[model samples]
Target: MALRLKDQLVGQVVDGRYEVLSRIAAGGMATVYLAADARLGRQVALKVMHPHLAADEVFVDRFAREARSAARLSHPGVVGVYDQGAEGGTVYLAMEHVPGRTLRDVLTERGALTAGEALAVVTAMLDALASAHRSDLVHRDVKPENILVGLDGRLRVADFGLARAASASTTAASVLIGTVAYLAPELVTQGRADARADVYAVGVVLFELLTGSLPFTGDVPAQVAYAHV
Candidate 1:
């Protein structure tokens, strides 16, 4: 079944500044919403951390750090994070709203893309990853679902929600958090990732875009993990 935002989030206000309009996407640690910025008079993408993650001190610290660091990065291909804070019990990030569909959505509808189109999308995503890498940030999650193609055909990488500073801890949990199909082998085997890891993910995405199937797939997480090997 197609995921619907309304079924995931309804009546959630983040930080009292971003009024959640509707759910856009849901992930393991957070839920993204199309929200209205009460003070700014504009639309914004609000990411509210899952209550379990929000209650974890380490996760909260990492979330705020990544939000602040991502905000410092100014690139057309990278989603801009404007604010990060907590209110009531919600921890959220207010980011620039890109009006378009995710690469995953496009792939789901079209099946596969032409070689040229696939290259275009991958190139844009790599550029964004390069920028993040240069700034010592690693987008732990790099997949079609995290890349958005705006109306102008510009690709913007979203969901820095899973990003962690290069200096942060790389535990087994972190390695398993990203999408199984697009995860780099190094991430799975060593719990270590860098710019090259991002490159590997882009390659996996390209493979999917060209073949309409993942390089690896299985019925369960363990089976998927073994497929990566």
Candidate 2:
């Protein structure tokens, strides 16, 4: 295994094609790196699965399947997955490097967005979700953090089919995955998630973008789960 960098992912080549330049973001399942594709001579966002997740065969299989599914979806509002591969025990995905702040960053800095801006962002997200749903793909995670607002004022959805895919085969009897405050009531209570579950999450995201806060808050997962009721 390569040494993990604390601040940046520099001086690392993924799959002998993408050279890591800097750390873009980190999530529960993967760490995203802004990398330069040596073969194509272009910038791309490389999402490498966390070491812990790589240890699970189910997660690895689901990650690859989701990457393949996401690659088939192309839209102005959906971030494109270009390639996926495993090299040196590292599984990485090559995606379009969207240049802009995340909706989470925007909301954090601006507090609350104007109605028009919020609607615009929601519309873009819904458009992307619609496209995915049309193709029988369900984006189980939809939140401000996963929504990127590009330099052109366009909103693009990222990490499509990732959370759902990773957690699909895992026993949902005890584990409560997903961001707490944004989880749909059905997902929390019934462990049933479909397109409507995504719609519910989208509604929650819009609620936060408009009110500058989550509709529910709790100290623990159980407390949060109760709030969903």
Candidate with top TM-score is 2
Candidate 1 segments exceeding 4 Å error? 1-13, 161-178
Measured with C-alpha atoms, the lDDT of residue 153 in candidate 2 is: 82
Q: Least lDDT summed over 10 consecutive residues: which range in candidate 2?
A: 169-178
lDDT of 1: 0.77
Q: In model 1, what is the error at residue 228, expressed in angstroms?
A: 2.4
lDDT of each: 0.77, 0.81
TM-score of 1: 0.88
CA lDDT for candidate 2: 0.81
lDDT of 2 by residue, 35-61 (tens): 999999999999887776676678778
Q: How close is every model to the real structure, measured as TM-score?
A: 0.88, 0.91
User: In candidate 1, which residue pairs get closer than 3 Å at backbone N, Cα or C atoms, i.e. clash?
Assistant: none
